[model samples]
Target chain A: MTVSIKITSPLTNADVEKLRAGDKVLITGVLYTARDAAHKRLIELLDKEGIALSAGKLPFDIKGQIIYYVGPTPAKPGQVIGSAGPTTSGRMDAYSPRLLDLGLKGMIGKGARSKDVLEAMKRNKAVYFAAVGGAAALIARAIKKAEVIAYEDLGPEAIRRLEVENFPAIVVNDAVGGDLFVQGVEKYRGTGND
Target chain B: MRKVSVKDITAKVKELCIAAACHLEPDAAAAIRVASEKEASPLGREVLAQIIKNFEIADAENVPMCQDTGISVFFVEAGRGVELDGSLEDAINEGVRQGYKDGYLRKSVCDPLKRTNTGDNTPAIIHTRMVEGDKVKIKFAPKGAGSENMSRLKMLKPSEGVPGIKGFVVEAVREAGGNPCPPIIVGVGIGGDFEQSAILAKKALLRPVGGKNLDGDVAGLEEELLKTINGLGIGPMGFGGTVTALAVHIETYPCHIASLPVAVNIQCHADRHKEAVI
Candidate 1:
């Protein structure tokens, strides 16, 4: 079995440089939750703020942070949160580049990314990780705490701040443009019916 | 003749909805464990392991296996002799409403254009068929959008034949790549009108995890497609590995000479489904 590397979020370039696609990692620190609706709103906020000729400020700082593309269920009583898992990331491709350019260091989600978003990640030294899709209840356990930071009216689609511990994920895209999905598939492809 | 109560149907659907969320159907669960053992890529194996572990945790804690508890979908086998005291449709919708509420499952249904939350997760997509038996069968499958969004439909010319069907199915999985979540179940519907094709594709998903089409030729195709998909190496969660799809299920119906309609419905590793007969 390949061993997992332990890493903290708010990752620096040096940390990102050492990572590669297919490397298992356990993340510990703060992760911001946002899915389709939240991503759209964040981009609109950026645009409006930019138009005002003010510091293109956001509800939270985008620098050195990771945005998790997830819209979790409402928590049960006496629970921190409900089954919280990553939604497909491809849906957010349209809005992701803008955030990545603003110094966002990483993202956690499932599925492949669009070309533009991926190029943006490589250009900006950001990384993409894949959490097991539909593995929400298990993933939620790593989230020690969660609270809505913005866009509360969107409910599950709202943006929230999560404090996590030993959050498991695998690096799918790295800063240097290594893609596990591509390489892995090519490796086994046409090694026919094996 | 069996007299199935409308309230009973509502009650059963309610529990099935909740159980479907919290539990990963046993066959799918077992398939993942089997896949984990044979996944060629270490990363792929890791993903399968996590999927299995997630279901176990969800089962024990009675929490949803995934947050996107899915858009509630049902297939009902209404017996010809059974008399319903009330509206069967209303009972099913009410059951979804109460289940999503009481179970704390996500209310994902929304108005397409208006994008408004239905609030109660109502108006389930139900397909009912009357059968000869006196017993009513309710099969519930909560479909997560992650996989459903990848589904596709096509009307092939009669010339496309079996090769055409196989080619289309393989290409659909290829294009779908890791998005539908690898280690997926490919449900292919052939030989029906456009809408019926789509429905058959979905109904194909309700088959037991490792089950095959009874027709010998169709069953042969299922095996071949499984090998080819696994060869794609989309692996588990599309991180690349040897096991891209757990199974490919094909359901076919007779169609017009000039037209062949095909639809592909992809189910992610979660594969949440349940059924009960009354």
Candidate 2:
């Protein structure tokens, strides 16, 4: 049985907390973007001794938000961005727990999560979603706007904010501690459900 | 006595780079189609077919096949008799700059310490060798990050032999699991020291999928390794299916009698690469 989910625009913390594993999401919302370098910088700033992103003082509030881990190629003339698709999320594992704690609701990327990340999602009531890793052109259709938010020095890997509608993804992990990769593998392995 | 201009080199490299990024090499595309047909698992077959469709759409729309357009790596064979009007290094860098720019490919390189993007995608990793001909040959492999992250090299005692080499390669890919993207192409570099082995392994990716290893004994090992890898059931994206690996390519060189060095360079299904001889 397949479960489906609808993610509305201008999402709030409440909307994100409701996602479950195996749910197919038709996400219509605004999102933020950050790849490896941006995530590193964001975390470093938070780690600084005297610096802080207190609830109201941070650059942006992440509660009920979705983050896409992507570093798209530069777009051609008349295009907004090029090859805008999800990158491997595992590389962001170190910084994710902190973001989750700070009210991150959902993550969109390809591949599996680290053990610590999975644990953080369970504790924080966030969800993990997967976009087709290489389907950049297809995914780009969902984006209505994309602009850099911070860390411009990182080029394509820099952090940005995106507005999207009907972005497609499948929930790979949920707040209840279910894991799609693990379950998906086990289901077909013995039964030869090929 | 043959003269080559930096502009010519740059233009050629730039053109090849974009071509490779936008289009799947014919052989690789063919291999994916064949794999899709032969895959036993319905899920695996579907995954394989989607990958093929991805290549088609990417080519049709002139977009990259995957978001991680990868670091710019080049293997060049230059002729001793040829002269470049400007620094060959400059020409190569200029080409990468233009390629990434004009191709709309990702500029992935960064300052290792600062972790800041170079913006122009300059200072590409280049390996050059002088060959007998007057024409220069170039191979471009825009390798993605996921596959590069899973690459590994191990130095073993010569006594460890074939079985040892096989075990290490399989272990590295298994540990990588879904991370590298499945139906991987495993390039095994045996012999040579650490760096040399890695270079050889990367070079092995230039071979067409299903191409036989030159060494008879190593070729046998290649077949055996391919079989063992498929048995892991990691499948496409490690989602669990019948075919985990599409092919394993092995290259070897004579090493010190006491040393056996092995390096594995894993390539995901995207496998975007190209070659040119001029």
Candidate 3:
């Protein structure tokens, strides 16, 4: 039962700095959902739009906002949304640097990060958080509302805007080059199973 | 001769798709529980706890446990004594269409090159074998790609032998790390041709979690690999702990004397699969 640091979205540089790898946080605010497919589309959208950050071509403002790497199941009758969970982040590595350049503050996903993505995060002062991989049913409880905002033609991979409440996540990689995945492994390695 | 209606097959498969999607089987659930108590990392323990609760929540709510319900895969044992009145494959695909739509499971199948979604999660990947029985046995495994994409198959030289198989399987899991979602179940297939070996690896996953191969040597390899994989400290969701893989299952077949084929199919903790005799 870890006491999580409660925070809201549109996190500032101070908010990102106060966090360290492995610290649990509960986020209550708006989050945008995107996966590899949506990410590719976004980068293409940006490249097409040129140097203007908010060239009016973008779907939503990327500045200081977090993009959760997820493609969730469909909602049933009387349900806000279906099983929503974090996907592997490595899949989004190729396009992340471009997003980071635009002041994207945080990312939520599972698995390890690529070196390029890490370097970009460091340069842009962003953070990476991880939600439990298979914990979709439980994770969905924290999401109060979800609506597709872009790429609806992508089906489940469509980008969506979500209003979340007390969403649980663990900071995996911080702007200071601290990574929970690396640190956790080093601590337990060669300790052997008991 | 027994007449097996495709309708019954369709009905059964429909039910199986929903069951496999929403529920976590007993073995998987129990393995996570065992890991939770022994998990060396507090964060790993916490993750394991969430997995346990996630399954329970899905079961109670009758919703899918994970967003990616997976590509519907089936292993069918069609009895020699039974005669099918219609196309078995068509029935299976129809079931998938209904199951995915009605179950609210995500339609994840897509064209490989064009990258266009099929909209309905069909046509299923079916492996049918003729067996000596009056009833048909269907086993359903909706494979999530996070783990499926990480699965690998290799053609080894005959001289590489058991050591080669062991090394490849362990290396695959290491490379996959948390991508497939640990603590994972590692399924190893050996001795068959390239495609057959891949199927053997996947079929191995349909076995009861922690179940050993009947071959004594194969079973030994499974135990050894299980221990080595757990030692990697990938832990639950790769946050690092002692329990990386819950089990390692191996299935083998006789292959060419000149070549040794091995496949490793990694399965996440969700491990949604079930079987029925109709």
Candidate 4:
């Protein structure tokens, strides 16, 4: 069954585990944005273990949060953000397992995740959600507010905190190991059955 | 010399860029239309419909077809008598910069090392060929990163032959799964060395869907590959279905006897490409 939720500022890890593939979600909450470069930094901090976060070496706490895989276009005047959409998820495959291990929960992006990341999601009771790729302008409207919370040097791929209301996404994976992409494909595969 | 100024070249290149990004080619458009009907799976059909809608919104609103907007790639064929009266490379680069800016498309080009976004979308990957006649034909394809990232090239043994090529492409697509966006068009480049094979694979993407290969042998091979790729059950968006691949285009050239190079460049349903001969 399709499900949508309203999330307030700062999502909890528990809330993320409730998502599963094949379930449509309308998320209303504050989610962080980070792409390849930011993800690299995030994992790098994680690699440092407790040493980084203990000394305030890191930028933000990833526990019980959502990160969007996006690199938006430059915004015009009077705009908080530009056309923001998900980048490919596989590019972040190497870093995702590390993030998942660090208490990260929900992720918003397009495309499929790597097997390693999926395994991580299953193990940690996390979820990966997909917003429609390329529907940037439409997706951007879902953002009620936007601000660069970290990684400003990374430009458009910087880490951002986005307050979104009714942002649409479909859960691509769930804690129980159900994969929406795989199941969706199987359900719609043109064999003898439709 | 034609004495084309930077402004003229930039304008032309920009035209090509915007045209390629905003509009879907006829064959690709047609393929999506067909997929909507032939797709037995309701979900597959729904995805195809959304793709078609994407094309419409992209064109109507003058927005980019996809947010990735893609790396600027120009396939140029110059006429025998034509001469560049400006900085050809600079003009092309300027065109890309302006096109992305004016079109509101994303700037995807970056320093591979620094990983810094170029901001202007410069340094386009330009391929030039001198051919007969007094015209410059430019084909611009704003290849999205998703599909481009999924591309692969394999150097197989000559003895492996047709089965090897088929196997490699199928494996590549299966591995790609939903990453490249399925209901894709597969471009195959065969018979060239490593670099040449990669270029050939990209060049093959210029061919119209359902277009026959120039050589009958290659055409037959393409058909076989198409059948096999569809059989992978990748379906639309990797959802299992019969129409995983809309078309498989093959381009072949003579190569050294010792090498069998095959490259596969996959294009998603949003195949934004255009060509102009001037």
Best by DockQ: 3
Model 3 alpha-carbon miss at residue B266, Å: 0.0
Task: Say which docking band candidate 1 falls in.
Answer: medium
Against the true structure, candidate 1 reaches a TM-score of: 0.97
Cα lDDT of model 1 by residue, A36-153, tens digit: 8888888887777674433247878888899998888889999999999888999999998988888899999988999999999999999999999888998999999999999898
Cα lDDT tens digits for candidate 1, B180-256 = 87789999999879899999999999999879899999999999989888887778888778888888999999888
TM-score of every model versus the real structure: 0.97, 0.92, 0.98, 0.90
> What are the per-residue Cα lDDT tens digits for candidate 2 across B66-154?
77788888999999889888888888889989988888888787788977678877788899999997888888888888888899999
Every prediction: chain A TM-score: 0.95, 0.90, 0.96, 0.88
**TM-score, candidate 4, chain B alone:** 0.96
Candidate 4: misplaced stretches above 4 Å? A1-14, A45-61, A76-81, A184-194, B1-3
lDDT of 4 by residue, A16-84 (tens): 656556666778887888888998887677576763354234576777778888887766566666667
Off by over 4 Å in 3: A52-56
- Ranked by TM-score, the better of candidates 1 and 4 is 1
Q: What is the docking quality class of candidate 2?
A: acceptable
Give the residue spans of candidate 2 off by over 4 A: A1-5, A9-20, A48-53, A187-194, B40-46
Tens digits of per-residue lDDT for model 3, A25-121: 9999999999988998998888777777472467888888999988889899889889998888899999999889888999999899999999999
Q: lDDT per residue, candidate 3, B25-127, as tens digits?
A: 8988887888789888888888998899999999999999999899999999999999999999999999999999999999999998888999999889999
Candidate 3 has which clashing residue pairs, if any? none
- Candidates 1 and 4: which is better by DockQ? 1
**Which structure among the candidates has the greatest TM-score?**
3
